[model samples]
Target: MIISNIAAPLLGLVDTAIIGHLPQSIYLSGVALGAMITSFTYLLCMFLRMTTTAEIAHAFGARRSDLAQQTTTHAVVIAAVLGLAIILLRPVILQLAWAVIEPDPELQRYASQYIDIRLWAAPAALINLVVLGILLGRQQAKYAMGLVIFTNAVNVVADIILIIGLDLNVVGAAWASVLAETSTAALGLWLIRDLLPPWRQWHITPAYFKQFGAMNRDVFIRSLLLQFCMAVMTGYAARFGAVTVAANAVLMQFLMLISLGLDGIAYAIEALLGAARGQGSRHKIRLWMRLCALWSLLFACAYSVVFWGFGDGIIRLLTDLPEVIQTAKLYLPWLIIMPLLGHWSYYFDGVYIGLGLTRAMRNTMAISVLGVFVPTWLISQQWLAEEHANHGLWLALSLFLLARGVTQWFYLKRHQRRLST
Candidate 1:
């Protein structure tokens, strides 16, 4: 799980390194913003991946091969449908992003170029999400790791050849990702053939359909709310000008790397927690939560130090642009502080999912979005308009992290007590 999560950002690191060296800063900013747009879109369907693992793992623990097969079929069907929907809605989505971010004309053009090419890979990307989830559920961690590594390795090489050798610019980066993801999806299908039932038996029964529908609806709502918050945050970043947006983008990569790496541990907890939940082992549930919390804090602190001490140098190595570097430096503290507050929220999310507390997760996130995120963002925007706008953006984002963490922890503690009683 660690290697799987790290491979993603490592792919971004390659793009950052290559694009950062381009002769112009606009291209760098363009790629960063473009990538963010793609990520936001892709992650909206992330529950396809997450829910699959949780459900399949639970089913596997119960020795229900039929249910596991049904889960895989449902996940694949949902992913394909969602992927198609995204492709169809590409124009509307991009238009909304443009309206919100309002990038410079040149940057906008580059963004469109990147999005246009990458959009074609939507089906493959979503399918890959389910594929990875199924593999993780089967406890094929090494295979899962290999699939991600293979995809990103291809991406890095393709990125270098397209961007540096062929001068395809931003489009090159996008194309590289599309190709890499497609390869990963194909390879993933081949690897997990044993887990899949025969093609003749692949049909969703009425009862199975009802359960799958419920899972899809619950998980989709949860993911949509999360993605909406992220989109709003990105919009705020974009409002601050290209350099500010670019700086935040670069800082975002670090956050992704750290958050996702920690998510590996969370994934482990989800698997264990789901299995315990299946067996109705309350003691094991508590044990998983405690161990995850302890490890989460330790990892968060270690990541914070790495970000504080080595982050600037890492940014400098990515790009030689003085302005971008300077902009990133001002906001470096947020990057360091983020893991401390943010990691717990992610960890708790896995725990909640394992306990089949999707409704609680959804409700807590909605409340945070309404009561915490919106008000804090509005206040920050007001302050920015008054003076020192850039600082206001960072402040707003930091508040979002703190709020999310606090609220999630609150709910989880309550849930823990309820379970105890």
Candidate 2:
């Protein structure tokens, strides 16, 4: 899981490297801005992935294969509808993004070019999310890992061939992602062909949608809150000028890389805890939580040490732009400290998803974003000068992670106490 997750972010790293080395830095900034917005939209729809994983895992634990199958089918259907809706509303979405991100006109043009191409893959991408959820739910981590690794491997190769070989630039990057996602979706379906319901046997009823709607509503809101924080970070960075946003893009990639690596353990926790919860094994759930936390702590410390020692070289590897490199250096300390500060939140996310305690998840995110992060950021802006505009953003992000992890811990302990009683 860790290996495959690492490969996933390396695709983004490849994109950043490809564009960062271009003669103009605008290409890199434009792609970064566009990708952030794209991620925001997809993440808002991420309930398809989380709820599917939780529900299917629960069904598997309860020995209800039929329910598991139905869960995947319903998730895919919902994903398809939402994906198509995104395509249909592209104009409005772009207009809204333009107002929020406020990219420079040239950067906006390049970003729009990339977004136009990539949006077509929405249906494929969302369906693939369901495929992954099924794979994870069934305790088929190896298959899920293989699928992710394969998808990223294809994406990297296509990105090189189209972007560097054909000189297609940003357009090539977008097309590369589109081809990769669509092809992977097909591969995922083929890989799970036996597990999927036969076309003739498949039936959708109002009850299925109702169940899905109920399960996903809280998950959707949780995801929206999370993604909104990210959007605000990216949007605010763009307001600081292209250099600030570009440098932030590089740093954010570092954060993503770390998150994905840690998520390997988180994914394991989700599977284990979900199954345990399904079977009413509170002891098993506690065991998984303890073990996952221990591993997460060790990994987080190791990453922090590595980032602190060799962070500069990593930045150089991402971009050749002198300004971007220097700007990234100014905020390098945050990257060093972030893993230890932020990793607990990532671990908590997996536990919450596994337990399907999404209302708690939603509440924590609201408190972190609105109650803690935003207020802290506003305060920081007043005290700091305009040149260090991003200091507050970084501070807010750290505080948000800390708040989330702490809040989740409180909730989990309370639940455990009640269970014991």
Regions of model 2 farther than 4 Å from truth: 6-8
lDDT of each: 0.79, 0.84
TM-score of each: 0.95, 0.97
Candidate 1 worst ten-residue window by lDDT: 385-394
CA RMSD of all predictions = 1.8, 1.5
Which candidate leads the pack in TM-score?
2
Locate the minimum summed-lDDT window of 10 residues in model 2: 3-12
Pairs of residues clashing in candidate 2: none
lDDT of 2 by residue, 1-421 (tens): 5664553355567788888998889889988888888778777887887788888889888988878878877787788889999999888889999987777899899989988888898898888878877888778888888888888878889988998899999999888888878998899889777667888877777887787787689888888888877777777888899999999999998898787768877777888889998898978988999999999999999999989989999999889999999999999899899889988998998999899888888888888889998898889888989997798899988888889899888988897788679
Model 1, stretches more than 4 Å misplaced? 385-387
What is the Cα-based lDDT of residue 99 in candidate 1? 88
Residue 196, model 2: lDDT of 74
Total colliding residue pairs, candidate 2: 0
